[model samples]
Target: MRLFLVLAFFGVLSLSAGVLMSGDDQDVDWLIAGGLFGVALAGEGARLWLRRGRAKSHESSGI
Candidate 1:
């Protein structure tokens, strides 16, 4: 699950960067890049929050 999340985050970053740096300033490209960025951020944030929650629970349970 962690590997999957990391891959997804990197995939979004790559796609966004590719589209934005393709020398095309079209509106659609911008929209796509923005969407990718948003998705990447959300994925990363969720992974971080979940990890933190799991660690806290583990500590509380003396794991």
Candidate 2:
């Protein structure tokens, strides 16, 4: 979970940098940015899924 958060943070940073640098130049970094953003999304989704699973398990266990 922490690892996913870190990866997502880096992905967001890279995406921001790419967007900032691409000032109408059709830069290739845009692709990198998109990919990073996708990773970020995936990481966040996975994190949420894991958290939800944990919560359900805890509920079932009466913890």
Per-prediction TM-score to the true structure, in the order listed: 0.54, 0.56
* lDDT tens per residue, model 2, 1-63: 786678768877977878777888756477768777777778777988999998988775556
Worst-scoring 10-residue span by lDDT in model 2 = 25-34
Residue 38: error of model 1 in Å? 0.6
The per-model lDDT (C-alpha) reads 0.71, 0.77
Residue 12 in candidate 1 has what lDDT? 71
**Alpha-carbon shift of residue 3 in model 1 (angstroms):** 13
RMSD (Cα, Å) of model 2: 5.3
Cα lDDT for residue 29, candidate 2: 75
Instruction: List where candidate 2 sits over 4 angstroms from the true fold.
Output: 1-12, 16-28, 60-63
Top TM-score hit: 2
Tell how far residue 36 is off in model 1, in angstroms.
Answer: 0.6
